[model samples]
Target: MNEDSLQHPKLERQPMEPRALKSIILSTITIVCAVTACIPLFSVLIMLLYRGGKRLTFQLFYTLPPGAFDAPGVGGFGHAILGTAFMVGIAGLISVPFGILAAIYLAELGPHHKVSEIARFCAKTMTGLPSIIAGVFAYAMVVLLMGHYSAWAGGIALSLLMIPTVMLTAEEAIKMVPNPMREAAYGMGCTPTQSLIKIILPVAMPSIITGVVLAVARAAGETAPLLFTALFSESWLAPNNPTASLAVLIYNWSSSPYQNLIELAWAASLILVVLVFFLNIISRAVGGKTKL
Candidate 1:
């Protein structure tokens, strides 16, 4: 046989089939559909940045809203900004410990146990529950009992929202820690709690931090729950006896008749987006480093 014919057998030189071409075409279509779904979110963000760009000034960060019928570029969201931070901080304080403990229980004790199974079910249910429902629950349980809306009430609501996120992320983080590490700690005469705190937790800190960051971001943007529980304020600053938050302010301004208030709303939104974006970036960087 000729060398050329021997080198390239008939089967080896076969052309690409129509079925393979169809599979490629279908995969391309699936990718296009996925990209198309993201367009609306991109468009909304673009519109917000464009409309709110002119009002994004230092004064917006420094001053409070002037009032109704005021011009586009007036007052800032300082009070709201401070309020959001305080509320979210309190929420984090409330959620993080519980979440970490729950995660540890799930990971260390094994999820196959009845208690772990129940905990997992509860977490899943809480995760799927509506934000408004959480708000209502807080209002009924905390606000009504307290006789009015308070920062504490808002913090509790945010904590409820945060717990599931933290728990799930923490569980995943704990699981990510290699089993050999735990075994090694045990081999060295470390107690279960000691191994968890000294070895597993330190190793999983990055993932836990990432989860906390994400939970904080979500809690920061929550409006519906804050509405029923936190309520809104124009005069009283958050961290006051009773707190007010950025989400409440945004909700109030966006629904107001005044263009100035609406503009302030947009500016507040820009601030929130920037804050959350930076948080996510930090979380990713830390997670990546720890992963390495």
Candidate 2:
């Protein structure tokens, strides 16, 4: 051996050090657990495809539901699809502004104020509020007052379900804005309102949008609330009339004695799943663009 090598001897390499072995063991366990968890999700997706895919036809998008006593497979739930869109649109209009404004107040304007604290507490409490309760509230507040089961009541019911989700998520997004941005805005003599509008809000907008999309997805899948407020209809959507939504359709048809109606329920279930999946994808995509 050379003199230098003899003076500075190299240690023998281990095939597997204890830490490395432990890491490998944990990684294997994690992967196995992750894969096991995904099995049920994949199984459900496969089942949906098998059962619902067969009924997906052009007519399914354009025709009304078949009569309960009519021939099998003669009609579709186009009205329900339209009603779902209308009520969700109305819910978005009602909730998005209120939720974002509440978030702004919580995260910026008066985060420590007593009123803010009360508002925050109310929002958190609402997050856990059951869909059935929201439905009941809408029924009592809107349906009874309006003296009818109309699309307006349904939209109001869905808006209640959406607001808490949007507000909490938006507050988190706003709070994530770097303090340096706020400081710099102040250093430039910008008012708090100006800074919020020009800097903080712009930076936080992507995440806010993500939250809105997620809230919409959740609202779209709600059945209990729509059942109480919108009820169900056999005709196309009307603002002053009972509405049909995919969730309600699925609930109403799933227990039917008719095989065709049961199949329609499966199709509606598949559509609702796909809609929620796409909304989630959109949320993730928008969230990826958040400045902070």
Candidate 3:
């Protein structure tokens, strides 16, 4: 070979300008699409606040609707608010323990066993199941057992919706716990259960709380399940005795012919959004504190 050919090698090269331009264009397009999709939700929120904020008084929180269009506001939503809280609370109570335990059992005790596989499959299946189906299942199971729509029935439906999410999230959180910490605990004479409780759990608490907050937010907004299982109330004040939730009330009011009812529905939607937002903020704060 000639000296030039022996000393020099062909250098494969790429044009930096085209690649950079293509990446910039793709990023811009992606952002634009995301912003466009978010617009409808933002618009609805703005419209709600503008048109319904004036109607959202302290009285609206406390009173229920009157029988007549012109009748004085005869009732408050204290009952509905309480009902929503109770139903969601009961659902969380049912879901969190089962989910977290199942996740622990799967991760620590039986990673590849038949039972764990079945549990995983069931959780995945449940995650995609519709809220209405959960309601129907609750109605068929618990409501039939009780012979009526009750808050417990509603709770069962919400639990069905929540458990899958909790299980998946718990598993992921536990998995994220550093193996070194677990080994250290084990080296220090900690049992598997003790290590899980004291080390893994504390370290993974932020993720667990995030999962719980998301579950609560989802359960709060669910109307179809409550509609079929809990039913609705016009004047009922107790959740345990079958009462309406804010979601059900919003559904009823938004569909009513009266403009005032529609306005109330918008106001209720705004309140629900605000409550969910605050819950998310609190969840973040808790997560941050746990990290420290």
Order of all candidates by TM-score, from best down to worst? 2, 1, 3
Which portions of model 1 miss their true places by more than 4 Å?
1-16, 236-242
Q: 129-162 in candidate 2: lDDT tens per residue?
A: 9999999999999999999999999999999999
lDDT, residue 244, candidate 1:
62
Task: Give the residue spans of candidate 2 off by over 4 A.
Answer: 1-25
Residue-level lDDT of model 1, residues 245-264, one tens digit each, is: 77788778898888888888
Best by TM-score: 2
Worst window of 10 by summed lDDT in candidate 2? 11-20
Error of 1 at 39 (Å): 1.6
Model 3 misplaced regions, further than 4 Å: 1-16, 71-75, 288-292
- As a TM-score, model 3 comes out at 0.88
TM-score of 1: 0.90
How accurate locally, in lDDT, is each candidate?
0.85, 0.93, 0.85
Q: Against the true structure, whose lDDT is highest?
A: 2
Which residue pairs collide in model 1, if any? 60-76, 63-76
TM-score of each: 0.90, 0.91, 0.88
Error of 3 at 199 (Å): 1.2
